[model samples]
Each structure stands twice: as C-alpha cells, then as structure tokens.
Target: MTEPLIELKGVSKSFGRHKVLDNVDLTIYRGEALGIIGPSGTGKSTILRVIAGLLSPDEGEIYVQGVRRDGLIEDGGQEVGIGMVFQQAALFDSLTVEENVGFLLYQNSNLPRSRIQDLVKEKLDMVGLPEVGHLYPAELSGGMRKRVSFARAIMSNPDDPTVGPEVLLYDEPTAGLDPIASTVIEDLIRYLQCLHGVCSTYAVVTHQDSTMRRTADRLIFLYEGRVQWQGTVSETYNTENPLIKQFLSGSVQGPIQVAG
Candidate 1:
C-alpha cells in the first residue's frame, strides 16, 4: 500500500476551556479526494488548520508522507510546500491577480521576469481565470477570488522534481455560492487535483448537502469534537446512526439534542 500522504495521531486541541478536538486520529492516502461533513462549529475547519500548521494540536503528532515535521517546517531554513484555499479568498488588496500568484516566485526563483510571467499566465489559465490576472481582488467576483487563491497557493511548486503543492487543503470551498457556481468550484477542485498530480486534497467542507454529495469520495461525520462515524457518501444516505440520520434528514426531532 502507498503510505498515507498525511496522518494525524491522537490529535487534540482546545480554545481556553472549550475543548474543540479530543484524541482525533485520521489518515489520508495519495491522490484521493476526501470530504468532511458535519454540523456547525464541529472543528472541521480546525482539522484543516492543524494539518496546515496554522494551528498546532495540544497533543498528538502530525506526519506528512510518513515523516515527522518540526513546527512550521524548515530544512536548511526554507518554507515547505502546501496549497490552501480559504473560505474567504484572503487575497492581498493591493496586489493584482498575476502579482499575487507570482509573488513567491519573484522573491525565491532566480528565473527571469518573462519566464515568471509566462508561468503565472499558465497557472491562471489552469484555474480558468486567464483574463483576470491583471485584475485586483476587489474587481473580481467571489468565485473569481477563490480561484485566485487556488492559483497562488499552487504557484510556487515548492517541492522540486514535482511541479506543485504536495497537499491541497480547502476550507469550505462551496460556501455562499449558488448551486451552479458551487458545482463549478467543485469541478475545479477535482480538476486541479488531477491536473497537477496532487498527492492528496483534504477538504473541510461545511454542512452543505449538494456540495458534499457532489464532491466527496469518503465522508467523515464530525459531531461534538469527535468523528462519530465515517463511510462513503452513499452510506451517509442510509446510515441508521441517529446523529447522521438526523443531520442528513434535516430533522430537528431526533437523538441530537439541540441546545435551547
């Protein structure tokens, strides 16, 4: 078997006195698209942050491709390779799309200006935003901004020999979009994975039914700080587990106790 591309061993986290995660363990295999489905405030996004080193788990070890990594990752003191798309596009207000996508290369690569420009254009084209490279974040639609974020995250190709991010983490990629638009983003996510030969794409998706059904190959249902149950998307439809059943059914009267 190909070793897991990413693994979280007995991971736990807390905010003040509120424990958000508790001894949660996970493993992701290479070249797979895995989606997390759960109700609100369940630490789904926090899992992504933990994987990205944006937030460290108070307990447990994190490994990438079967090797342990130190805090923030440095070998000979350089940044490691990972791509991310945030729920909010999180683009720099002053930078044009091309500038944002190519920002890392300009600072790191010794390649000439023309070559960098060509690379930037190619990246933009890959994300279906060839014309928007010259535009700023404010000028584009929300969907466009998300695409820009995707492009920039994968732009540097930080790892050698391979040409892009090893892992792609997305935080609620389909939020606040119409059905058609959400599907477009979902398709784009899959396309990017296949096109770049990404090792694995881990997504922290919200409680959007269509997005989950359309995108996820495997579904892990997080409830009250733990992964209560897990299975494929189709299994989610027939689950007898009350939380899973109550959630997917959109029912208020079930085993799930909603606080008053």
Candidate 2:
C-alpha cells in the first residue's frame, strides 16, 4: 500500500486523571476517506484534535508526510496541509459568512479585498450555499452553518496552493441535523471529496451509521480509547467482531457497556 499521508504512532492522551486515548496508532492514506466511530467519551474527536495539532499527545509521535510534528513550533498543518471542520460549526458570530470564509486569506495572504471576496463567493457556491454570503452564523440554520464551515475549510487562493488543506479532518459533520439534513450533509461530504476538487484526504468522526457508510470507504471502530476493529465500510455490517456487531446492531448487551 502507499505510505500513509498522516500517521500516529503510539499516541496517548489524558485529561487530568481520565485517559482519553491509549497507545493508539492510526494511518491515513492520500485521497482516502476514513470514518472514526465509537461510543461517547471514546476519544474519537480527540484523535482528530491531536492530528489537527490543536492538542499535543502526552506520549506518542505524529508524522505528517513523513515528518515528525513533535518539534514543530507551530501547528503541524504547514507541513501536511491539514484543515478541520469542527462538530459545533465553530463560526464567528460577529462575522458574515463571506468574512468567515475568507478570514484566513484576509489575515494571512497578500490577496486584495476584491479577490478575497470573489474567492469566498466561489467557495460558498461550491458548498451549495450560494448567495448566503451576506448572512451571519446566527442568521443561518444549523445545516447552513455547517456548510459555511465546510466552505471555510476549503477556502484557498489557488495562486498559492500552500494555503489549502490537503488533509481534511471532520468532527461529526452530520451531528445534530435531522435525518433529511443529515443526508444532505452526508451527500455533500461525498460531493466535496469526489467533485469539489478541494482536499485530498478526509477523516470523519460521526455517530450516524448512514454518515459513516456513505462517507467513508474504510472505518476504524474506536472503543475504550483504542481501535477495536478496522475494516472496509461494507465489512462493517457483516463483521462478526463483537464490538462491531454491538455497535452496528445498537445492542445494549455486548462488550460495550452503558455507564450508569
């Protein structure tokens, strides 16, 4: 197989006395869409944070494009082009959609105001949020806000490819949406990867089965802070692995326990 575009070796993280991740190792290949699934408090989103360089691992190493990120002064994104769409649609309430989308370019690039606005409109259109550039996060619906986040994640001035994200990390892209909205977001995720020509690799953390099956070609079942099973999306439904079966079947009786 091709060498992984991003790799986490023996990664472990903790919050105070509670361990969130334990000696976890994962690899994400170029152009692959991977899904991370697990019960609550299982460190699914924590893995994304570590990979995105938002949090440092207590013990372990992270390599992006074969370069270790431990010694990097800034977030490791510069080395591997990492971008993240947060679960909460962490948009700036004070900024309009256009401003939110073009914030990075406005602050970091030499591009003129007109060019930035033009690029913002283009990205909004790409996410199917056309003509909503004037709205603010508070003015949009939940799904619209999520799409705006996606637009920001993919915003890039093609003149300088270095600014674009090659590896996109999504923390529950379909999280609180209704079934219909969730399906729209799921389809949008696939559309972005296949047709939008934005990021090259994606790793999504989601609880929705439909989101997982539709967006990920491969999946890692995270349980108790470690990967309990890894398989193709198709195999996920057919696997006899107890942990997976319990998760897929949504059975209360299995290796997985409900903490009371």
Candidate 3:
C-alpha cells in the first residue's frame, strides 16, 4: 500500500470559543484527487489551511510525506511542498498575469527573468489561458482569474526544485461562476494536475456538485466540524446516510438545522 502523502491525526481547531474543527483525521495519498464537501462553516477551508501550514491546529499532528513540521514554515523549508488556491482567486491586482504567475520565482529565486517568463507562458498555456499573460487581473473575467490563480499556485522556482509543491489544496475553486465557466474550471483543474507532475496529491473544498463529481476520486463529507462520512464519488450518490442525503437534496428539513 502507498503511504499517504499528507496526514492529519486527531486534529482540532478553534477560533476564540467557536470550535471549527474537531478531531478530524484525514489521509491524502499520492496521485489521487480528494474532495472535501459539506455545508458552510463546516471547516472545509480550515482543513486546507492546516494542510498548507497557513493555520496550525491547536491539537493534533500534521505529517507531510511522513515527516512532522513545526509552526509556520520558515523560508527555504520545502519538505511539505504545499500549495493553496484561495476561494476568491487572490491575485495581485496591480501585476500583469505573467507577473502574477511568476511572482514567487522572480522574487525568491535566482532564475533569469527570461526563463521565468518562459515558465509562466507554459503554465498559462497549460491552463488554457495562453497569450493572456500581458493582461491584468481586472481585465479578465472571474473564471480567468481562477485559472490564473491555479497557475500561480503551481508555479515553482526552477532554481530551487524543492519549492515546487507536492500537494495542492484548493478552497472553493468553482465559486461565483456560471455553470459553463464552472465546468471550464473543473476541466482545467484536472488538466493542470496531469500536466504538473510535481504535485502528486490534491484536495479540494467545494460545494459545487458537478465540480465534486468530476474532479474528486474520493469524497469526504464534513459536517459540524467532523468528517461525518467518506467514500468514493459514486458512493456519494448512493449513500443512505442522512447528512449525505440532506446535502444532496439541499433540503431545509433534515437532521442538519440551519442557524436562525
């Protein structure tokens, strides 16, 4: 059996008095795409943060590639090799698309500007946004921004091979897009994963049904800060689990009650 690329053991997190994640254990294996799905405020995004080293758990241990890490990762530590794409795209509005995609390399590595430009063009092309590198973020549509965000998240500094990410975490990659655009982004996500061999594992937190169905090989249902259930994507549609049923049906009346 293949060892998990990333593992969270008995993880728990809280903001002030509000507990967001509780004893959540997850394992992400190599060469697999996993989806974390649930209602809002279920800490799906928080899970990605913890994995990315952006947020540390108050309780539990995080192991990446079987090594434990401490605190926020300092400069030049690349063992974890994690990348994240925020829900809002989070592009630097002032920079051109090429600059945005190549920001890390230009700022942190010794790579010549010409080489970085070539890599940026390759990534943009991989995401099906070829020749848009000269455009600014504001000039592009929401879906384009999302694709650019993916390109940026996966971009690595060739000078420092360790800087390349081994695990990609996405927080709501398909939000705020029309159905057609959402499908485009979904397809792009799969395409980029295959193209970027550096990233061996991926986890996505999303509420889009089509995106989940199309992108995820395995599905985890998070509810009330816990991993309520997990299974293959096909099992998600056939489960008799109440929470899964309610979520699939989007019914207001069920075991899960909405906040008044």
Candidate 4:
C-alpha cells in the first residue's frame, strides 16, 4: 500500500466535557477513496473539520506527508492543497457562483482577475455546470449548490496546479439532494479523484449508503466516538459486526441506541 498522505493517531476531541472523538486513529493513502459513516453527531463532520485544519483535537497528533498539522484552526486551506466541501455547500450568499468558486484565488493569488474568471469557468465546466458561475446560491437548486461547492473544492487545484491542494475532504456531499442528483455528486467525486492523479487523498464523511458505496473504495465506520469497524465497501455489506450490520440494515434493534 502507498504511504499515508494524511494520518491521525490517538486523535480525540471534545466540547467542554462532551467528547466528540475518542482516541480515534485513521489514515488515508494517496489517491484512495475512504468514506466515513456513522450515526448523527457521531463526530463525522468533526473529522472533516480536523482534516481540513478547521478544528484542533485536544489530544493525539495529525500528520500530512509525515509533517504534523499546525495552525489548523486559523486557516481553512493549505499552500500545498487540502480542499474541503462543507455540508451546506457553504456558498457565500453575497457572491456569485464564479466569485464563490474563485474566492480563494482572489484572496491568495497574484493572478489577474481575468485569469481567475477563466479558472472558474473551467471548474464549472468540469462539473457539467458551465453556465452557472454567474448565478447566485439563492438562484440555484440544492443540487446545483452542491455542484458549486464541489466545483470550488476541486477547481483551485486543477486551475493552478501550483497553488492547488493535494488532499480533498467532503462533509456530506450528498446531504440534501434527490437520488439522481446524489448519484451525480458521487460520479463527480470519483471523477475528480481520477482526474487529479495520485497526489490526492480523499476522506468523505457521509451516512448515505449509496454515497458510501459509490465513493469509497474503503469504508470506515465510526460509532459512539470510536472507530467500530473498517473495511472495504463490499465487506461492509456482509460484515457480521453488530454495529455495522445495524447501520447497513438501518435497524434499531442492534447495539446502537437512538437518543431522543
């Protein structure tokens, strides 16, 4: 196996006394699709935040390419390449789709405005939404909004290979879309991975079965703040482990408990 592009050891985090991640250890190899699945509030999104350098774990260490992650809470991106798409698409209401997609370039690049516009156009086209860059978040459907985020996440890297990030992260890429649109998102995920070559690593956090199956070559199941199971997507469907079985089957009678 290729060496891990990103790794977490004994990673743990909490808000006050409420622990969200409990000594979690996981890793992502270069150019592999790793999907994270678990119950709601099971720290799925938190993992993305940490990997994207948005949140700091109280304990444990995070490393990228053998270098420990630092200044995560203050910066949302990297000079190398770590891209993340938030759950809500998180598009700025005040910016056009092109503006939203190219915001990073605007903030950090020395490129001319016209060059940034061209870069945005190419990204939007890559996602099969070539004409919406001029549109607003409010003007697009939920599916469109997700595509916008997806475009933004991958655009910078592909646009200017120098400033583009090497790692990609997704926070529920298919959270609020129809099955058809969800499938499109999944296809885009795979497409982006393939298009980016082997320098990229992806860790997508999602509970949606189809998304998990379609995007993940391997699956990591988190339960009660710990990694309960980890295996290939095919193995997941057949696992006898109660927590995973319960989750795959969507059964309420297993070891998992639902809190009101």
Q: Clashes in model 4: which pairs? A: 81-165, 81-166
lDDT ranking from best candidate downward:
2, 3, 4, 1
Predicted structure 1: lDDT: 0.79
Deviation of model 1 at 146, angstroms: 1.1
Model 2, global lDDT = 0.90
RMSD of model 3 against the true structure: 1.3
lDDT by residue (111-146, candidate 3, tens digit) is: 889999999998888888998999999999999999
- lDDT by residue (tens digit), candidate 1, 93-135: 9998988888878877777878888888988998899898788
lDDT of 2 by residue, 100-201 (tens): 999999998999999999999989988898899998899999999999999999888778877888888999999899999998898888888886558868
Query: Alpha-carbon error at 240 in model 3, in Å?
Result: 0.6
Query: Candidate 2, which segments miss by more than 4 Å at Cα?
Result: 71-77
Q: Residue 65 of model 1: what lDDT?
A: 69
Candidate that beats the other on TM-score, 2 or 4, i.e. the better one = 2
Per-model lDDT: 0.79, 0.90, 0.89, 0.85
Q: Can you tell me which runs of candidate 4 are displaced by over 4 Å?
A: 73-80, 157-162, 197-199
lDDT of residue 101 for candidate 3: 98
How many collisions per candidate?
Answer: 0, 0, 0, 2
Q: Which pairs clash inside model 3?
A: none
Cα displacement (Å) at residue 230, model 1? 0.8
